[model samples]
Target chain A: MTLAASPHHILTVTVENKPGVLSRVAGLFSRRAFNIVSLAVSPTDDERFSRMTIVVDAESAPLEQVVKQLNKLIPVIKITEVPPAEGVERELMLVIVKAAAETRGQVTELTAIFEAKIVDVGYDAMTIMVVGEPEKLDAFSDLVKPFGIVELQRTGRIALPKLARESTRLRSVKTARA
Target chain B: MKLTGAQALIKSLEMEQVEVMFGLPGGAILPVYDPLIDSSIRHILVRHEQGAGHMASGYAHATGRPGVAMVTSGPAATNIVTPLCDAYMDSIPVVVITGQVAYSVIGTDAFQEADTVGITMPVTKHNWLISDAQDIPRVVREAFHVATTGRPGPVLIDLPKDVANAPMEWYWPEKVDMPGYKPNVKGHPRQIKDAAKLINEARRPVIYAGGGIMLANASNELRALAELTGLPAVTTLMGRGALPDEHPLCLGMPGMHGNFTAVTAMQKADLLITLGARFDDRVTGKVSTFAPDAKVIHVDIDPAELGKVRLADVPIVGDLRTVIDEMIKALKSERSKQDPPDLAPWLATIHDWQERYPLKYRQEEGGPLKPQFVIESLRDNTPDDCILVSGVGQHQMWASQLWKFKLPNTWVNSGGLGTMGYAVPAAVGAKVGRPDRMVWAIDGDGCFQMTAQELVTAASERIPVKIAILNNAYLGMVRQWQELFYEERYSEVYLSPDLPDYVKWAEAMGCVGMRVDTADDVVATIEKANEIDDRPVVIDFRTDWREKVYPMVAAGSSNDDIILGPEFGEGGR
Candidate 1:
C-alpha cells in the first residue's frame, strides 16, 4: 500500500481526562521526532474524556507510526484520522490590524467580505474575530496584511468527520415508495 | 482497613504474590521501609540503585514475572535510568517504585526531589505520580498490569514522601480500570490463515523466532511449527534460548555478529515467518538489501512493531503463543488440502553453509586463553539448565555464539540496549528467582568494573551466583574495532590486566575469587568455582585480547557481505 502523500495529517484523539495525559501525548510526539504542525485540546462532551486535535507533518514521520505510537500510551482511548477532504475543519483567528480613519472603512469592508466580526475596537486598531476553514483564514490573513496588522493569533484547528450523505438513488427510491 | 500508604503499598505487593524485591532505602523512602520490616516479602538491599533495577530485570527474565525494584527520588532515581531504558528496549516486565518528595514541594526542588515521572516517561511503558494516598492499591495493580501485558516493558510509580506517610483506607483493587489499555492476545483469523498459506507455499521459509517466543512461553509452539513444516529456524540474539541451539533445524543467532549460516539463511530465504521479533537494523543489515525477494509474515503482540521497519505481507498482531497455535492449526488444514512444499533443498543448502563456515576458534596448548574456548568450557562444565547471563562487549557476543542454549529463560543479557555491567546484578537476581538452577554471569573486565560491587550484596545475602570475568586487559570489543577500523591506534580502550586485581577485589567483597591465565587452568578454575555452593564465586579468566567476534556484517553493510574469521581461509570475505 502506498503511504499518504499529504504533508499534513490531522488526527482526532480521545484520551482519559487525567493529569499529565497531555504531557504524555506531547512527550511521545517529541521523543519520536514527529513534528506537530498544530495542536488544540479541550474537554469532550464526557467530562472524563478529553479530545485532542493534532495536525502532524507526515514528512518527518509516517502517519501510521505516529498513530500506532500514540495508541500505545495508556491514556489514549481512540485515535481517528480526519483527512482534509473527508472532514470539516475550522480555525479561529483574532487579529488587531492598524485601521486608521482612512483605512477603517476598508478594513471593515474587508472583514464584512470575509464575514469576520470586529470583537474589539481600539482608537487606532480593530481586533477582528474571523472563524473559517484554515485555508480561508489563511486567505483572510493575507488580505488583511496590506492594512498593517499589529498582532495576530490563530487558535490552531479543530476537526470532525463530515456527516455521511444519503445516496441520491436511495432517496429517489424512498420517494417512489412514499 | 485504615493504614498508612506505605502499609497499603506493601500489602498491595503481597496481594500481587511478589516474593522478593531489590532496592535500597533512603530518607524519602524511609516510611516505605518501615512497612517492609513486618512484610513477608524478602527485600534484597542492593549496593546501588542501578543494581536494583538490573536485578529486577534479571528476575523478570529468569522467572517470567514482573520484577520489582524500589528506589528513592533524585540521584537514586537517576541511577536506575540505564536499567529502565535497557528493560524498555528488551521488553522486560519491570515495575519500579520511586520515592518522591512531598507533593507540595515537588516543584520546589526540595531535598532529594526529582521529577521522576517526567524523567522516566519516555522509557517506561507507563508511569504514575501518586498524589492521593488512597490511589496506592489501584495504581500498583495498574503498574503491574501495564508492565506485564502487551509488549512487556518497564513501568514506574513515583510515590511522594507525604503521600506515603499519609493515612488511607486500604482496599485491594479486584480489577484494573484501564479503559484505554487492552492488549490484543489472539490473532485475526484472516491474518493467521494468510500466514499459514504463505508458509505452505514457500519452499525456502525460515522461522525467525525472536525473544517474543520465550516471553510468551511459545517455545513448544515454535518447535511444533518448525518440525511440522521441516523449516529451518534462526533465533536472534534476544531469542537465544527460544529454540534449543542443538536442534537440527536451528541455525543459531542471526544479526551483525551472527553465524554465517544464520545470516545467509535469512539473506537467501524466499519467505521469512518472523515471530515476536522486530526487523531491527542489527538483524537486517542495510534493510534495503535484506531478504530482497522474501515476503515477510511478521507476528507481534504490538501492532506498532508490525510495519515499523519492513512492511509485512501478513502482519498478525497477537501474543506469540496464541498466534503460533492458530498458525499451526491453519497450516495443518492447508497442508491436508495440498502437499507441503518440499524444503529438502533449502535444508540441504543451510546444512552446506553450516558445514562450510562453521563457528571456529583455536586454543593452542599453554597458549593464552581464548575467550571462545572459555565459553565452550563453561558450556561443557555447567549443568544443562543453568541460566547464563552476560554483560555487553566481545564476551557477550562470544557467549551468544558459543553457548548451546537448550532451554527457554536459560540465556539472559542486555540484548537491545547492550548495557554494560548487566551480568553481576542480573545473575544475582536470576539466582534469587530460580534457586533451583545454577546462575553464571560471564562478564568482561570493563563490564565487571562497572557493577562488580554487586558481588558484595550477593556475598552478604549468600546468593551463590558464579561469575567468570573474561579479563582481556582492554575494552575488548572497542579495542577490536579500533584495531580493525582505525589502523590499530589503540587509544583509551586498554584497562591494565592487574590494575584493580579482581581476585583481591572479590575477596574484599567476601567471596571466593580465582584467576586463570593459561588455557590449561581455565577448565579447572571453572570446575572449582562450580563446586562452591555456599557463597558467590568470581573467576578472573585472563583471555587473549586479539580475538574478534567473526561472521560480522559491519554496521550498515548487507548480510551478503558477512566477514568471516581467518579460519575460513581465502573465503573469509
Candidate 2:
C-alpha cells in the first residue's frame, strides 16, 4: 500500500556565513530537484553563521532524503524539521499598486482593513507592506490585483517554535556534590 | 615575513605536508608554478587537466591520503570537472587548486576566465575563492581538513591571479576554526547495543559492505566482525576489497553485474546489516522489492545515508572502524554459545546459488579471445598485491567480477561517476604513489581512447604502469544496453577497429606496445608487459565483441529479474 503523502515541512538549517554557502545549499535543492515552497535566509546571533528556514512540500520529494543531502553540505552545521503543529510561521510582503487620485481613498480603506502600512507614496502609486502567514499574503495579493498592482516582493516564510527552548543541545556535566 | 600570494600558497601546501601534486600549467596558473622550483613538493606535469585530476584521485585511493591537483583558469578548470564529480561520487579525498582571472575582472569576462566556484559548487564537498593572499594558509588547512574527514570527497580552492601576485604576511593557523564542520566519530552506545542484539538474533543474516570500509581503513574490523559472527559479506563495486576475495565468508560483489550468489543471497536474506554503505540504486535494484523480507541495520559516518533510501531499524552514525570495533565489543560482552545465530542453512543455500550460476564464459577453440578470458588470465598472472584500475564499461564490470582483490586499496576505478578514460591516468597516479608496487590499468577500447594520451606522461616520468585494452571495437556497455533494451538497434556505439592502431600509438608515446588476438597469447603478453618496469606498456587484446556481461539485472528492475547469459540456456545448460 502506498503511504499517505506527508504534509509541508519547515527545516531550520544553521551554516557558516561564507560567500558560497548560500549557492551550495540552493544548488543542492535544484540539482536534486527538490522543490522549495518558501525560503528565508538571515544571519544568526553569532555573526560567523547564518540560519535558513526552508519550507518544503514533502509530497513533492522525500523529506528524509532532503535532510540527508543538506547534511552532506560542508557548511551546514545543524538541521531540524519543525512540524506545523510545533511552530508559528510568518511572511512579509511589499506591494506597490496604482493609487491614482480616483481610488486613493478606497485603497487606504483596504490597507486599514488588512492592517497593512503605506510605506511609500508616489505621484501615481502607493507601496503597502504586509506581514502574515503565506495564505494571508496570497489573499491580499488577489484583492489588490484588481487595483492594478505595479510591483510585489515577498520574504519567504520564516518560523520559530511556540515553546521556548535551547536551539541546540549542549553536553551537560552533572555534579555529584549536590 | 611578507610573501607574494603564490609563495604563500606554496608555503601553505608545505605546511600540510603535501609531498606531490598533479597538474598542467597555463597562463593564469603560471605565477603559482614559478614558485614550485623552490618548494619541497614534487610536481608531475600532466598532458591534460583531466588527467591531472584523475591522477590525484588515483593517488588518494592508493595512499589513503588527500591527493592534490592544480590547473589553470577557464578550459583547464572545465576539463577537471569529470574527475571532481568522480571523486565526489566515490568519496575519494582530493583537493583541487585552480587559477582564476584577476578578482577585479571576475564578472567582466576577462581572458581565460571561468566562474570556478559556481561551476564546481555542486560537485565539490566545499570550495573557496581567495580574496587576499593572507587567507591562503587558513584556507589550505581547511580544504585538506574538509576533503579528508567524515565521508571523504573532493574540495576546490580557486586563486585569482591578482591575489597570487599581491604581497601579504603569511602565518599558519594553529587550528581550523570551522564550527559548522564537526563529524561524529563514535556511534551511540545504545545504537551499538541494538546492532549487536540484531546480529545475535538474525537467523539468515548478510553483511552488505560498501566503499566506506575501504575509505575508513576498516577492512580488518569488517573481516573480524564477519568471521566472528559467521555472516556472509557481499561488497559493492566501490567496496571490492573490504574483505579478501578468497575469504570463505566473502560473497564478492552485489549489483547489476554482481555474482548470482551475492545478488540472490541479498534478496533472500532475512537480516541485512549494512556497514559504511549507502543503499545506492545500483546495489538495490528495485527499492520496493529489494530485501523485501529483511530488517535493515545501516551504519555510516554520514547521518543522512542511514534513512536516505532504505530505513534503518538500528541506525548508527559514526566512523566505520570505530563503530565496528564497538559492535564487536558489545557482542563479546553479551556473548553466549547458545545465542549465536545458526547460519548453516543459509550458507548451504548460497552454495547452491553459486554452483548453479557461477560467473562463466566459454572460449572458442583457437579463435578470438573473450573479454572474460583475458581478465581471468590477467588475474591468474598478476601478483596478489598488484593494484588494478579500470575505466567504466563492460570491462569495468568484468574486472570487478573476475579479478581477485586480496588487499585493500588495490582496486581503483571510477565507481560513482562511471567515467571513461579514468584508467590510464589513475594507474599512473597509483604507480607514482606506490612506486614499489605494480599497477595495471584494465580498460576497454572505448574508454581507453578517452585519456590514453596520459601514457606519454607515465612513460616520460618513468611511472612504469601497465595497460591492458580489452578491444571490442565498440562502446560495449552501450551496445549491450541497446541489444537488450532497444531491440538490437545499434546506433553510433562503434569506434573503428583499426583507427590510430593502438600498438603504434603506444610506441609513439615511448612505451612498449603489444597486441594479443588469440586466447593462448593473453598470458604471454601480460608476462612480457610485466617484465618491462623501466617504462609504461600498453597491450591491446582483441576480444570478441558479441559477449555481454551476464547475471544482469536491467537498470531499475528488481533483482528477481536477473537475466542470465546464453550460457545458462533453457533447462540451465
Candidate 3:
C-alpha cells in the first residue's frame, strides 16, 4: 500500500501576554519534536494577550496531539487550525542577489515580473523585497536562485481565516427576499 | 485587605483548602516562608528538594487531590526537575512553586538565579512567572485549575523575590478564564451506542482499563461494566487496583511483566474495550502483533491518546466515569435481550491459561529466599488496606504481580517514568496524607541507595512509613538483562552486600531497621516493622539475587514470545 503523507497545517494560538509564555510554547513544540515550519507572534488589540500563527508540518507529528498539548498550556487562551484553502497566508522575503552592471537589467526585469520592489542597491548586489503568499515567495525565490544570490531572509508566514457572512444571516436574508 | 504577595499566596492556598505542603526554604523563598508562620497549612521540611516534589506527588496519588511543593531558586529549582518529569510522565496533578531572583535582576543572571521557568517549561502542563504582586491570586487559582483538570499533570509557578515582597491588596479571581483548556467530559451518544454494540457482539472481549479509571474515580463503574457484561478485564501497571484483585473478572496487570493469562488473552482477544489507557510501547509489545485480531473501542479523556499509537474502531473521548456511565446505560438495554451472546467458552479458555501458567516461583528446601516468595509473605501478613509503593526494578514488578490490590489508590509506584528512587518519599507522603493506613515502600538495594536520605525527613516528621528493602546485592533487573541479552558479561551491576549496612544506616537516621536473611524471618520481621507507628522502620530482606521476573516479553518483541520461568516446566527460557 502507498503511504499517504499528511499535509502541513497552520495553527493559530492565542495566549496571555506574560513573561516566558513564548518560551513555554516553543519549548512544547521542541520537546515533542514537531517541526514548526514558520511562526509569527504579535500582541493582540488587547494588551493582556498575544496571538501566534504557527505553520506546523503535520506529516512529521500527529497534528491532533500537538493541538491537544497546546491546549494544556495555561496561558494559551484559544487555538484554531486554519485549513490551507479557508485561510489567507502571507510572507515577506528580502533577497540580496549579485547584480553587476552586466546582470542588472535581467535582475530588474525579473523583479518587475514578480512585482517586487528594490529595497537597496550596492556596487555588486541589489536587495529586493517581495510580499505575497508563501507559495508566491517560494516561486520568486526559485526564480532568483540562478542569479548567484548573496543573501536571503523571510518573515515566516502569518495567516487569518477568510472573512465570510454567517450562513444563518445569509439564509435569513434570502428568506426575507423570497 | 492590603497584604504582601507572600501573604496573598498563603491566603489563596487556604482558600483552595490546602492542608499540607512539602518543601525546603532558602534565601529567595524566605519571603514566602515568613507568611507560612501564621498560615494554617502544615509544611513538612524535606531533606532534599526532590523529596519535596515526590512527596507532593505521593500525596496527590493517595488522596486524589493536587499535591503542593515549594522550593527556592537555582540549585533547589534544578533538583526538583526529576520529580516534575516523573509527575509529568505519570500524569499526576502536582503544583510546584519555586523562588526566583528579583524580577529586576532576572535577565542579568543574578546570584542564585537559574531561569526556573525556562528549565521547567517542557515538563510542566503549564507555568507562570509572577512579575506583578496583583497577579498572585489569579495565578494561584489558574495554577491549581490547570494542574488538576483534563489530563492532569504537574504545573509550576515561579515567584520572583521582588514579587513576593511587593505589597498589594489581594483579591481572588471568581472564575478561571481558560477557554482553550476545556476537556471534553461527555461522550457522544452515537459513539457510546457504537461501543456498547461492539461490546455486546464480541465473544472474546476484554476490558483493558488504565489509570484513567482511578483519575476519574470510575472504578465502581468499571467493575459494574465488567460484572454486568460478564467480561474479563486486565489493567495496565498504572491501572492496578481499579478493580479488586479477587474480583472474578479481574485478570490483573497486562504488559512486560504481567501475568501469563493477561498476555495471552490480549494476543487472542477478538475485541478490546480500552478505557483511559494509552497504548504505550511497553503495553503494546511489537505493535504489529499486539491484540492482532481485536477490534479496539478506545475511550480516554484526551483525544490525542485515542489514535496516537493504534487506530480505534470506535473512539470515545470523554471523562472515563461519564463515558462508562453512558456505556452502562446503553449496555443495560442490550443486556435485557433474552439470548445474549455466550462468552463461556472464552472464559473457560482464559481459566485454563490462568490455571496452567499461574505466576510461579519455588524455593529449594533451605536455599535462598525467592523475591516472589518474600512478596507473597508480605501480602499474606500486611493488612488488606495497607498501601504499597515500590521503586522501579525487578522488585517493583514482583510487587505488581504478587501483591493483590483490593482498593483504589492503594498501589502508588512510579509507573510511567519508572523512576528508581521514588518509593521512600512517596510512601512518606502517602502516610502523611492517609495517617490511618499502613504504608510500605518495597524497594531494591540499588533503588534504595538512590534516595535513602529521605528517611531522615520521614523520621524527623514522624511519618511512620515502613520501608521493606528487597536487598539482592546486585542491580538485579540489569543483571538479569545482562545475563539474558549480553552473554552474562556483567559490567557494573554488582553492589557489595557488605557495603553500608542498611540496618546501621537506618539507625543513623533514627529509624528502626532489621535484617532478615532467611524465609522463616520474613513474617516476624514484617510484623515487628508494622508494630511501630511512632517512627519510620526499614526491614532489609536479603532475597535471592539470581531470581528474575518471569513471563518476560523480551524488549520490543511480541507478547506472544513470553518466556516463562523454569517452574512452568515447558516454556523455560
Candidate 4:
C-alpha cells in the first residue's frame, strides 16, 4: 500500500556536532526532498556527535534517498527509514470539544471507545486525552467532530518497530561467533 | 549523588542530541516530566498518549531520524500499540519510553500498572525494562544504537516509575556496546564475484534498486554499477532517484504506479539484479508472473530479504555501497556487452506498449480540474530541488504516476505502510529540515482530514510548507475499486459529507490558503502559495469528485492484466 504525501511517516536522525556538519547533513535531507517534522540537535553519548530525528511522510524510495544523502555526511554515522508497520509508532493529540449537557454523556461514551481520558473539563467544553494509534484516534476524533471539536493538537509520530525473530536469533549467533 | 531520571534519560538522549519528543504526562511519569522542564528538549504535548507515538514516528520519518515518545504506565503505555504495530511492520525507528507503576508495583496490577515490555515485545526492534536507576543511561544509549542501525526499526525502553525518578550517577558510554547489533557493511568477496559473473553472462539485464540503496547511501555506487554493467536501472518507490531521471540508462519507477516502459522492461528482462528492494506487491504486480524468465540476483543488508518472495539466483548480503564497490573492483568493464542478441524485438515490444497505454486523465467532460494537472503544476512550480510529500489513495498514485521524479527523497509518501494523512505533517517536517527548498503536501480529500491538525504545527513553526489538496470528495482509490470491481456500489466510500472546507480550515489554522476550482487556477494558486511568508499555505483543488486512476492491474493479476488508459495500445501486450 503506497501512501501518497500522507502525514503518517516520520524520520529521526542524530548526528555529530561539528561546524558545517549540520549544514552538510541538512543539505542532504533537503537535497533529497526529505522533510524534517521536528529537528533538534544537541548533545549525545559523545560530545562529538548529536542525534536528529525528523518526520517525513514519504514512500520508501524518496525517504531512502534522504537517508543515503545523510549517510554521505561525514558527521552522520548512520541513517534509517522507519516505516509505520515495521515499528511501534504513536502520535500525540490534544482535542477540545463541546460538552453541553445533552452531548456530554455521548461524548464521554465516544471518548471511552477511543479510550480518551479527560484532562480538563468545563461546562461548555472538555479537553479530552486519547492516545492510541492514528486510526483509533482518528475514528474517535471523527466521532467527536459532529459534536463540534473546537481545537486539536497532535504531536508528530514516534515509533519502535520490533526486530524480526531471525535477527533476535542472529544476536545470539553473533555472540557465539564472537 | 543523584540525577533525575528524566535528567538521566535526557542526558542519555542528549548523548543522541535528544531535541524533540512527543508525549503526555500522567501520575507515574510526573517525576520524569519534571526534569524535562529544566532541559532544552522540546516536548510536543499531544491530546492523547497514542498520538505521542505517531508524532514521534512522523517526526522520525520526515527527518530520517529516530523519533522518541514517552508515556505513563498501563493504558498510556498500551495506548501506543497501534502505531507500534504500524512501525513494527513498516520498519520505522521509534523509541517508546513508557513509565511504569514503579518497580515494586510492576506485577501487582497496581493503579496504572501494565506489562509494557511484554506488550511491546513483538512490536519494537527491541524492548528493555529498566528497574534500576543506574541502567537508564545504558538502556537509552542502547536504544538509539539499535533503533537506527542496519535495516533501521523501532526500539523501546520501558522505565519503571521508581526507576525514572530514581537517582543515578550519570555515566555515558563512549560507544554503544550492542553485542547483538552488528550490521554487515561489506559484501562477501565470493558473492560479489558471482554477481559479476551473472552480470557478464546476462543477455538482457535490468537492475532494480530498493530502499536499501538509500539505506546504504549507495546511489553513486548503484549508478556506477548500472553504468559499468550497461544495464538499464529500474527503481522501487523507496529506491526512487537511485539514479537521476535524465540518465539514459534509467528506467523510471517500477511497481503498481510505475511507467509502462518500466514495467514492460522488467517483464522482458532475462537477468534481473535486485538491490536493497524487497519484492513488494506494488512492484511485482503478481508474484508468479513477475519476471518469469529472469534470473534474479538479490543484494541486501538483511539476509532474510534474499528470498522472501522472488527467489534470488545469487544472494549477496552486505551494505549496498560496499557491495557495489566490491563488484566494481571485481567486475571487468571490457566484458560489458550490448543487450541480448534479440534485443530489438524486445525493445520494439516495449516501445509499442508505451505508445499503446500512455498515462492520461481527462477533466470529467465538463469538469473544472484534473488530478494530474494539480501534480504537474506543483512539479513545475516546485524548485528542482524541492520535496513533494503525498497522502495515500489516488493522489499518491497520481503523483507517482505524473511527477517527474529525477532524484530520490524528493518525493515523500508512505509505501510499505500505506498510511494516509502522512503528507501534510511530513511536508512540515521536510520544510523544517530544509527551509530553502519548497515543500508541497499533495493529498486527496479523504487523507487530508486525517492529520490535518498538524497544519497548526506547520503554521506555528513558521515552516513555509504548502498543501495541495486534490478534493475528489471520496476515498478515490477504494471508490475506484468499488466502481470497477463492485459495480460502482460507492458504499461508504463517498467522503462528501465528512470532508472539511479545507480553505477555511487552513485559514483557521493561520495559514495562507486558497482553493482552485479549475485547471487555470492551479498554477496561480500554487504560485501564490509559494510566495507566502513564514507560514504554511493550502490549496484545495476542487477536482472531479469521482474519477478512476488508470493503469491499474487487478489484485492477484499478472503484468498482462494492466488496464492502460484508452490511449496506450496495451501495457506491453
Candidate 5:
C-alpha cells in the first residue's frame, strides 16, 4: 500500500471529467479529513458513468462525512459504504523478477507458496502473477524481494460487491426500467 | 443496425474537420480501429500514446486548428493525460479520444479498462464519456468547439466499445448549442472605454500579452493597438512571439530569466494594459510588489481569470480581437486627452538597469558546448516563418531570450505547467501543421530525455523537426537549486549511470543524431541537423553541467531584486 493508505471503505461515484473533478473529489476527502487508500475508476460500458471505487483512510465518522461531500458533486451519483470483511476487494499485480538458473528453483518455490503462477520464464528472469486482496499481494511481493525484484507494475485496485449477485439483480431491474 | 461506440466516435470526429489523428493502437480501441478502415481520417501511428496527444497539441499550436488524438483505455489513456495537461496549461486546442469497456461491466473489473475521464478530470479543460449513441455527435461537436475556442485546451471523449458498433444515421451539424459553453466575445463597452482612458492618460504604459493572443489569432489586432497607442510592450513567457521581438517598443519578456530592461520598465509603469494575458507568477514577481503602483486593465476571454490573482481596475471580459479593436476606437475618441508623453526618463532608467545587469554569460570563452550560443545560432539560421518549440526550465528561458520570434503561434511551449517533455512532439505537430516551414525543438538534456522517444514519430512521418538538445547531463534546474539552497550537497542530480548515447539513440529511433562536445562543432552540427531533408535530427551538445542561468529573481521576489551575471545568477545572492 502507498504511504497514504486509507482504511477499507467503498465508494461509487460518477464524474464529468472537466477540469478539477479530481481536485474536487480529493478536496472533499481532505476537507472532511479523510485519506483514500485505494482507488479505481473506469468509464461504464456505455461510456457515461465513470465509476470510482475509493477506499477512505479515515475512521467511520470522517469517511462518512467525506462520502456525503462527494455525493454533493453534480457528477457524483452515489457513494455507498462497504464493510471490508464482507466486500470482495481484489488487486492484480505483475512482478518482473531477476533470477539466475541457480536461484530459479527458489523463486519457483516462493511463487508456489503464494498460489502464484509463473507467467513467463526467460533465460535470466521470470515474471509472476498475483491476484488477491491488496494485503495478500503485498505480503506475497515482500517475500520475493530477497530474490531480487526487477520491477513491479500494478493495475491499481478494482472491486465488486461480496453480494455481487444482488447488485446484478438491481442492475437488471434498473435496465428493465430504463 | 448496430454500431460500436468507437465507430460513432470515428464518425463524429470525421464530421469535425479532423483529417489527422496521432495515437498508438491498443485492445480497448480495436473496435474503433475496425471501423476506421472506412473513414477518411488518417491516424499517424506513434510509438507511445503520450506522443499522440503532444503531436495533436503541436498541430493545434502550429495551424491555429484543433488537433486530435486517439488511444485505448487504461495506461494508454493515462499516457495521454500528461500531454492533455500540457495542452490545458499552455492553452493549445486538442481533442483526445479514448475507448472504454462496455457499460455492463463498469465496476465489475473489466479487462484493459480504466476510468480515463476520472483520472483526467484535473488535467483537461473539459472531457466527456459518451455512453449513448444519441449524445455522441452532439458531445463530439461540443468537445471540438470547446477545445478550439476561447482559451483553447485539450478535451477528451471516451467512447465505449459497444457504442461504436451500434448503428445510427451519421449527420454533421453546422454548429452546436451548448448551454454551459457560452464564451464571452464582446468586451464590456464601459471597461473598454476605461482602458482607453487609462492608456491615453498615462505617462508610462506597457502592453503585456500572452498565449491568448494565439488562441484569439489577435496578433494583428495586438500589433495595431500597440502601434496606435505607442505603448512599449512586454510579453509573458508564453507570449514570446505575440509581437515581433525586434519592435523598438517591445521590452522582451518579464520576470525570472526576463530581461533587466523589461522588468525595470514593468516596475516603472503607471498603467499596465494586460491584454490576452493573466499576470502569471513568473511574470509578476512577488504578488504584492508586482506592478504595485500600476492601475491594471486586464482584458481576457475567460471570466474566471478576472481578479483570480491581481485586481483589475478595468476588467474587460471579451474576445481579444474585439477588445483590442474597441480599445483603439475609444483611444481615438479620447485622443485630445493624451498625456504629455516622454518616456525619456523611463527609458533612461531602463538603459541604466540594462548596463548594470547585462545578460552576459561568464562561462569560458572556448569551453564545452553551451546552449546559449546554440539557441542564438538556431534563431539566426531558422527561417523567418519557422516555428520554435522548447522544453521546460532554463533552456526554455534561453530559447525565449535568444530567439527573435516575429509572429504569434510560431513559438509553442508549456509555460504555466512547465512540462519538460512538451517540445519534441509539439515540434512534430508544428511540422505537420506547416509542412512548408522549418520547425526546431530546443530542449535541455533532462527535458529531451523525458520525451526523446518522439524522434520515432518524426522519422515515421517524414516530419523533420530539428531537436537541439542542450545536454548538461545533470537535471540542470534541480542541480542549480541543490547548489544554491542545499549547500551544493549534489543530491540525486548526477546521472553517472550509463544512459543512452543520444548519437546512436536517434539512429536507433530511425532519425539522424549528432553530438557536439565542443563549441567549435556546434554551428556545423546544427547546420547539418537542419539539412537532413525531411528526417528529424537530434544534436546533443555535451554542455557543462555545473553552471546556472543569470538574471534570476527568486520565485516570489520583487522584479527589482533580480541578481545578474552568471556565477549562479539569482541563486548566488
Candidate 6:
C-alpha cells in the first residue's frame, strides 16, 4: 500500500519494557527527521511489554519507511498501523478558558453541547475536561479560543483497532460455509 | 560458581569464540580490565579509542566475522563514535563494549560518565546499558547476535562500573529469544519467480553487485548467476571484489570515479538486477536521472533499503545467498519454457566503451612518480591474496579503480562513510584477523597523518601489515574538486610533502620506513617492503599532486554527463 496517501498515520508499537526504550523510539524519530505529531506510552497488561501510540505526520517521512525503520529497533516488538477510519482513537484535553461572569453562561452551554465536564470553577476561568477523538478535540479548542484559553494540556492520542461489525462477521461465515 | 560481572563478560566473549579484541583501559573500565589478564582473548592496546574501533571494523571486513572493541566511558566512548557510524553506514559487524560510570552515579555527571547508549542510538544496529550484573551474559549474547545478523552493523553494550564489579553466577544462554529480532533469510517464492521472469525478459541487463554479497558470502552464487545468464556485472566500491576483476563479465567498479564502461552501462541498461546493493548517491549520481530506462529488481536484507531512493519493480527482502540460489533455480525452470534474451549487442557496446576509454595514466622514465603507477607497482608486487585496505581520498579511489581484486573480502575501504584515517589501524586489525595473508594499507599523505600513530600499536603487537602512503602532500580529492569545480581556488588543501619526515617517524615507531621519489624506485621499494615479515613497513611514495581521478560525474549531475580525462582529446566528454 502507498503510505503517502494520508498525511496522518497512527502506529501502535509494542516494545519491550526495558529502560531507555522510550528515548530510543523518540530519538529514532528525531534522528530520521520524521515528525511525531502525537505520542502516548503506557505499560501493557503483560508487564514485560509496553504499548506506544504514535501519530506521525506522513508528509515528513513516508509511512512505510517509518514503520520499517521502527521495526528494526531491537526493543520494538511489533508495529500495527491503525487507519483513522478502521480504528477507535481518543485524546484527552484539559483547557482552562477565560470564562468570567459575563461569558460564564455561554461557556457552560458550549461545554454541555460537547458533553465536556467542568472539573474546576475559578474566579475568572473554568477548567473543562474534554475526551474525544483528535478531530473533536480540535473543534472544541477552536470554538473556545474566542473565550481565551488560559492553560491547555493535551494527552496526545491513544488508539485501538475497532471491533468487526456483526454483518461483516456473518458474511465471512457464509463465505466459509460456501 | 559465582564470578564478577567483568569475568562473566570475558567468559561470554570466549564462549562466542572471539579470539582477539582491540581496546584501551581507563578508570571507568578498569574493573573489566582486571579480568582480561586471565581471558583467552588477545587484547591489542590501541593508541586511541578511534583506532580500536577502526581496527575492529578492519578485522570484521577481512575475516567476515564480528570484530570486538572495548573502551572506557565519556571521552573514550565518544572517540569511537566515528568508527561506529562508519560501521553502521557500511553494514560492518562490530560489537563495541564501553564502560560507564557506576550505576549509582550514572545521572550525577560523575567522572568519565556519558550516556554512551543514547549518543550511539542512531548509529548502532542495537545497544544496551546493563542495569543488573546478572544480565551480563544474556546482553553480551544478544549484542553479538544482533551485530552479526541481518544487515550486520555495529552494536554497543555500555557496562556500568558497579555492574562490572558486582557478583553474579555466570551461565551462557543456550538460545537467544528476542521476539523483536528475527531476520528473514529466505525470499518469497512468488517474488523469486517474478524476478526470474524479469531476468529472462530483459535485453540489456547488468548485475549491480554491492558489499552485501561479500557480507552474505554469496560471491560464488553471484558468479554462478552471471555466468549462467551471460550477464555483465558492475561492482560498486564496496563490492569491488565480489566479482573477480579478471572475470570476463566483470565490468569493474561503477560510481563517480568508476570506469566509463561500467557507469555508462548502468546508465544505458534496460534492466538492472541489483543484488544487495543500495542506490547510493555516489553510485547513482543524480537519483532522478539514474538508469532512467532500466527496470530494477532490487534485493536486500534490509526492507527499508528497498524503494528508499529508487522504486524497485520487484523488491525482494531476504538473505542474498538464499535469494540468489532460489533465483538461479527459478531462472532455470523459466528457461525450460523460453530462451533468455540475447545480450550480444549489449555486450559488444560495453566492450567498445571499455576499449575507447580505459583507465589510463602517464609517467615518464626517471621522472616524478605517479600515484596510479605506484598503486600498479604495489598491486603487481604484492601477493595475489593480499588484503588491500585504504583510507578515503583520491588514493582510495585510485586503489579501487586500479587494483585487480580477484577474490571476495580482499578489497576493504570506508565506502559509505568515506572516513579518512581508516587505513593504518584497520590494517593492523586485518593482519591480526588473517596473519597468514599479506595486508597492505594504501593511504594518502593527508590520511596517513590522521591516524599514523596506529603504526606503534601494530609494531608493538608485531602485526606485519605494510603501509604504502601515496604522499601527494594534499587533501587530494578535495583539491581535485577545488581545481575542477571551484576554478582552481585551492583553500586549505595543501599539506607540504616534507612535513615531519615520514621515514624518521616510522623509525621512531619501530617500523621499517623507505622513500621513493622517482618512477624507477617504485617497484623496488614495494618489493622490499613486501619482503619484511617481522615488523610493520611504511613506504612513502612522493607522487605528483596534479593528477585527479577521472571518468567523473560531477555531484548532482546525471551519470550521462561523465567527463573522461584529458587523454580523450579536448573537452573529453
Q: How high is the lDDT of residue B472 in model 2?
A: 95
Model 4 residue A14 distance off true place after TM-score fit, in angstroms:
33
Task: Sort the predicted structures by TM-score, highest score first.
Answer: 6, 1, 3, 2, 5, 4
- Name the lDDT value of residue B383 in candidate 3: 91
Top DockQ prediction, candidate number: 1
DockQ for model 6 equals: 0.80
Weakest 10 consecutive residues of candidate 5 chain A by summed lDDT: A1-10
Candidate 5: tens digits of C-alpha lDDT, residues B269-313: 898888878888888889898877799999888765777678889
For every model in order, the fraction of real contacts preserved is 0.91, 0.87, 0.78, 0.00, 0.00, 0.91
lDDT of 3: 0.90
Pairs of residues clashing in candidate 2: none
Error of 6 at B90 (Å): 0.8
Preferred candidate (DockQ higher): 2 or 5: 2
Q: List the residue pairs that clash in candidate 6.
A: none
Which regions of candidate 3 are displaced past 4 Å?
A: A1-7, A44-48, A162-178, B337-339, B570-573
Of the two candidates 2 and 5, the one with more favorable TM-score, higher being better, is 2
- Encode model 6's per-residue lDDT on B321-355: one tens digit a residue: 99999999999999999998788988999999999
Scoring each candidate complex against the real one, what DockQ results? 0.84, 0.59, 0.59, 0.01, 0.02, 0.80
Give the DockQ-based CAPRI class for model 5: incorrect
lDDT (Cα atoms) of all candidates against the true structure: 0.93, 0.91, 0.90, 0.74, 0.79, 0.93
Candidate 6, which segments miss by more than 4 Å at Cα?
Answer: A1-6, A167-178
TM-score of each: 0.97, 0.95, 0.96, 0.72, 0.76, 0.98
